[model samples]
Target: MLDLAYDLPAPKVIRGALHDWELVIGLEVHAQVSSKAKLFSGASTRFGAEPNSNVAFVDAGMPGMLPVINEGCVALAVKTGLGLKAQINLRSAFDRKNYFYPDLPQGYQISQLYHPIVGEGEVIVDMAPGVARRVRIERIHLEQDAGKSIHDMDPHMSFVDLNRTGVALMEIVSRPDIRGPEEAAAYVGKLRQILRYLGTCDGNMQNGNMRADVNVSVCRPGDYEKYQESQDFRHLGTRCEIKNMNSMRFIQQAIDVEARRQIAILEDGGSVVQETRLYDPDKGETRSMRSKEEAHDYRYFPDPDLLPLEIEQGFVDEIAASLPELPDEKKARFVTEFGLTEYDASVLTADVTNAAYFEEVARGRDGKLAANWVINELFGRLKKDDRAITDSPVSAGQLGKIVGLISSDAISGKIGKDLFEIVYTEGGDPEEIVEARGMKQVTDTSAIEAAVDEIIAANPAQVEKAKQNPKLAGWFVGQVMKATGGKANPKAVNEIVAAKLG
Candidate 1:
């Protein structure tokens, strides 16, 4: 529902020797479906196993070996589509995309072309705090992945690893709504986050679990607006596809470099070539791979082995009902229910584990106090040790107990932090830790007042100066804290100090 086109000014279209241009982009993100088995085979879909160790006869394309559909894979694809709020097709069919590659042992890929599993979805990507952009999803189809071809180990021969072969992929196509590189990166990140939350894809680019092909085109400014208005794309100019971008940072960098490359060519009175390009991170540039392929190039046709996939509406409704509270909803609830700042809620909900941990620590306690301890003290310590929230030494229950003690005035803030260290390292109940360490607050008003009176008597000259300047009275409170070994309640010290000074 978020509009990306809002606040974006339409660029002026110019027809000149050196005319300014607009860059229009769309993305085809291939996310490996998170299932234990491959799409059409029983081969284990594990990463970094001994080469070909995870392959089956069907994955290796052994003669007469037939392909069988993996229902778990279908469920994942459907879940991902639901996460994007896309229309789920009750009936869809797979087809054979015939191609020839040394790594593609089947010589044909089983893919969905004619009827995809999902149709027409939209993604709302938050670019910054208040800015959101919507990118339209054209379709999401399932396809089997090809194997890996290793050419580096030998000069005269290439080796193929079919371990990755027949693995499931969801090709989520986006309309060319992106106008800049930063927005493109943001769109991919938001998609990854949603898929992860859905438990449909691991969304790990480093492990080759997800990748994107960015289609970029440059036109005279305002041509993009005209295309939006009239649905005429001829005015948008030739498009180049950047293939297999694996990193978010590299995606943005590739776009910037590719746009400038096209701009330089057009400025020199040369037209930009429409081709498939690859990005070289070392050189920070994109080079042409080949002319981009059309749908007919692959010779798509309905597969003979697999039938059309269909499910009842009740199944789809079940998935919708079981959906977890996602990131955006959790963030809003944290801000509204817990009284947290937008920034604080965002930080806590960015990761599911962190949000769950925060909820546990905040249970039945002061929300702001729990958030302060978790975000400031706990997260700071975890970062120093290079650990995640799940790896924290202090459990959520222990943290909640610590917050309770602070709220009940059983310990001062300083003593609470000391208790945290004890519980974090020594591993014991907070009350027991405070008792053993004598870290309980000096809540006895008589004891606190004695320390405050002693400090005031020792600094009569300072007390006289305090009467002249009320702000200077805080100096006496600090002195009382030092006199009591930091065990005096800060509020009690302040009250006693103020009374004596007056």
Candidate 2:
């Protein structure tokens, strides 16, 4: 078993009129499976298709159209379970969660409630350097997504787009281990990163590929500990479900506002009511949507259309073996193998594409130097241009060459920056450009000593000041570098300058 223990940070306390309160948050993240087809239909799961173009007979709930489960979605769900380190139930069943909505053409959603596909996993959220919180996974159930209802296009009528109908979603439910708004956002982010790395979900919140329903409740400081000591809900106050929060910023904002609202209610001598609510970003408040539904409310029953799903141990083993190195494992390897700070490793490994790019650039080069160039120089430039790593002008091979040049003392650090700019704009080999442009560092002792001697002789008064204060020696080194157009080897320039000044 993985060590999921870490020091929990101080709870985010909300000062109420009557009593101070602490936030307890849990997230139900709905991640669309990265499959081309829908869960139980043959329709294409493309996002921007014409309305109803992607709908199948079964998806429309047409008469006598029995649902046939898609094998690909099941495989992806199992893959997600393995990625989360969750238990994959060999025999899991699907049930119909009966609900009525205009977008839900079937009048019900096929989801797992009793026998979830995955069970009992934990997510270790890295809150800070050496500080982590273990958020337990209650279950991950496979379900079909409802079609979208577009209301704003017309004032008098609404339109339904069935592009997302019957789309497979893995409802990743977490235990209420999150104590604050920021941690809530971080937990979702970490979960999204893991999902993206697993190739099971795209984790694109904007595209509606992923979204979270946050369960927020407020309690007194010691109440949370009491709830933890004994598995009881009385200690943890009634939680309101904030529905369909896509943005991380909004997720945090909603939690804070909701917690404060709950505190305000309790202070006013009213008990909190459990309900489903929607977060209005513009108003920065949550409004009640409906009373929170329980299992009996949903009228959940086993789906007669589909049988119980059973998989062999070999099947699960195959997926586990095929699993790529996850974010946490990759981050740990980067810190140990490359001697990187945990912060740097975390930044690099936050995205799978960025991590791959870093690995390629650091393959044979000095890992620390490569990381510095990639993070500071390359990433900074990319950000300035409003570009992603994939759209970066400098390729990994080009960056690796630049780092190699600096590592081998073929070019000074300053010269390397200039080379990076030239390659980023014009595009060429780093070494060939250095040679063609005469950008190689002046490492020869004779040339460097001559330059240093000239600087010291020209600035006798400054040299005396440098001899008095050792820090003043940097002026002469700067002069030497300027004289050589920043091509002088910095180490060699410093050595010569110090000797001549002394």
Candidate 3:
């Protein structure tokens, strides 16, 4: 339950020749559960194994090999449900979804159709600072992933790799609550962050650990409200499912293109047909793959090989207790506790590793100063080098000490940059480096006064000009800092310079 019922303007609307239209989006996100073994067999779920090497006999659909459920996978699904604030069905059953493909060795995907493990949750998508929309969760079902079919490996013959066969997946289906392309992307990002925070899934789209099937449709504005009140889906129009979208940019692009395509057909006095489609990013359009299939088309039936999955209320409570603090909770805490702006908190809490690093650096320290150093200095440097927070050369403890030195005026900001560079390259103590290299700020008023006096004496005309125009007083401050070998405390120098000039 996100408080996103408040009215907000729709950002994406197609101004068709006949009328205006808005996009409706729903996502069926597939996330690979983080476990050491496959869903039904103990085959290694590790990535990048030799082709077909990680296959178990059951995963390969060998004759007489019966599938057994992995207990850890079940726990992960339950944990994810609790994290999403959804209802957990203590007794849920699995069904066989009949399909045929080269990647599917068993010619069917074992999924939950009649009853899913999780239901009726909502995700609060941060569209902008202090602006959000809630996307309701329809269901989450656990299923086995198919193997990979490589067509380019050999031109004469296609190759199949069973390494990913029988891997566990949580298909999180969202209600068609999204109103725009950007909202759709934001919704996906929010789910990915929650999954990663819960440790249920890694959410690595590049490696195919998580992907989304975007269902895009178009309808008029008031029609959506009518459907909302009546709970009728026809007002939303025919939704085409865009399959296997891994890139967020591509998701947005596909939704826009697909919506316009549907609008064109409707405007031409032709009815829109529901179907499965593929987005070609190169061509910037969606091509029809096949007619959309209903649940009956899959011929779903209770999986006879496995019994109905039944767990006690105590088991559900146990997994619920083990759930981690999700993204929204963490982001709120970061803002209140650290005095960080919503945007800063959002950036810091975008990933689990970044949030942990920021916390370690900001603990018991000036939160604002720590945030500046972590975001502006450390993160800037890491981004420059194209490295991740986990690959940071400056450890959390080291970065914390550097911020401490700057806050205490033990070192000026310039000297802090120097110290950071030294630690980043050679790796050493921040305080020790400041002391060893004489990077400490010259807080002694007399020493700074003497430098100011010398600089004034050397440039009499310039001192007179500075006194005439107070704005030029900073010139004397810079000169004094240089005379002190860039060690003068800037605030003290400004004070003493103004006094001497007056």
Candidate 4:
């Protein structure tokens, strides 16, 4: 986590009338483990269930009910830790995080603070092509999620949904390594990618499966570095937490809005308060929720019902062995083996499904052509249609065939695009479509030469201009393609046109 090999940028300080202020951010991301049962109870952890239908007696905090730790949840936490390259603590205990909320019938949330299962991990967040930042993970602790308290259900009263009660959560806490709003979002995105790859957490932020509590603080120009060297917390200024951020767009917006609010306070000769705040994206501002509490305030103590978790190194090794080729490794392989650009590889490998699709499409084909079609044509259409890669109408095999045809000069790129459109909407094989519609490229050099001669003879004026300026020769190729109804191989047409003009 504290590895200093990365080329992380310095804190981006903004100049003001009084002084330059640097933004310091840390995120506590709570991701729900993708298990069927709750953390301690046998209650189903299914989403959108009836208000309390998924609750077990233990989850409902019935009298005399005790918690039994779920081994699956613990295994997931370890798997996630390994995915992040973190230390897995074989022995960790659960503590009661006492707080009063209607949704939490138990009156105390089971969590780990002093002894966390995972520690000292780092996530590499890609800011741009060939640029990244390594945000340090302080610890990842397993905890029980409190249920939902819905305020808009009724006019006079709020409704409580205990279905989420006792659900398992991996609260991944990070150090204050993030410098900007975009970096914070990138960090979260990268972490979510890793978790999804591990199959531990689904990384679905919109469904309350994953949410971030962002801690933001402001400092002077050199204060960030000073705090790093001295290991002091106060140099970073008083922090305000924006809670339950679910969307990347809103996350960046909340940080910027909060930073400006803090700046205004400091510029007015006022001190910032340490409190929990909520970002209202609709209103474009943050409002106070409650004062931030220290660990002592929670009266955290080891839970009596749950025993200290103990595991063997062999368990960790097994999980590590089962790990998939993660996004970073896959991206590197795509760039090295497929000759893809850094940006294209990053975009393609950002999601598991997208990467798999691209891999299949690029297999034994011209990797560059496949990447271009996937990144530009297929991805563009999916974005326009509001669809995921999994929802794509054109399968990987179908798209790969399109690229193959283009590579083999069996069809021109124009015809290949037409073939893709037919497969996406109408659904058919690229080869069959080309054959059925007489769309196969005329790669025969003699046929292309005859078409070029006919076009050149008819359009003598354009040919004379093209010969004067060789760059204008593109017009001759276009004319030949148009004469052949875009069925002629573009390369062959270009060659024939160039030779005739010469």
Runs of candidate 4 with Cα error greater than 4 angstroms are 1-5, 459-472
Local distance difference test, candidate 3: 0.90
Our tally of clashes for model 3 stands at: 0
Candidate 2 has an lDDT of 0.92
Global lDDT of each model? Answer: 0.87, 0.92, 0.90, 0.91
TM-score for all predictions? Answer: 0.94, 0.97, 0.97, 0.96
Ranking by TM-score: 3, 2, 4, 1
Considering summed lDDT, which 10 consecutive residues are worst modelled in model 3?
1-10
* Model 4, span 1-502: residue lDDT tens: 1122466655767666788899999999999999999999999998888788999998888999999999999999999998999999989999999999999999999999899999889898877666678888999999999988999978999999999999999999999999999889888999999998888999998899999999998998888888989989999999999999999999999998998899989999999999999999889999999999999999999999988988999998998899999889888888889998878888888889899999999999999999999999999999999998888999999999999999998888888888888999999888888888998888889988988888888988988898789999999888888888998888778888889999
Q: Model 4: which residue pairs collide?
A: none
Off by over 4 Å in 2: 1-5
Q: Best candidate per lDDT, number?
A: 2
Count of steric clashes across candidates, in order? 2, 0, 0, 0
Q: Is candidate 1 or candidate 2 better by lDDT?
A: 2
Q: Candidate 1 residues 133-202, lDDT tens each?
A: 7789999999999999999999999898888999999999999888788889888988987888888898
> Which residue pairs show collisions in model 2?
none
The sequence of per-residue lDDT tens digits that candidate 2 reaches over residues 1-502 is 1233497655899898778899988899999999999999899998888888999999998989998888889888889999889999999999999989999998999999999989989888888886788889999999999999999999999999888989999999999889999999999999999999999999999999999999999999899899989989889999999999999999999999999999999999999999999999999999999999889998899999999998888988988999999999999899888888888999999999999999999997799999999999999999999999999989999999999999999998888898999999999999999999999988899998988888888888997888899999998888988998888899988888777766
Lowest summed lDDT across 10 adjacent residues in model 1 is found at 1-10
Error of 2 at 375 (Å): 0.7
Candidate 1, after superposition: displacement of residue 355 in Å?
1.1
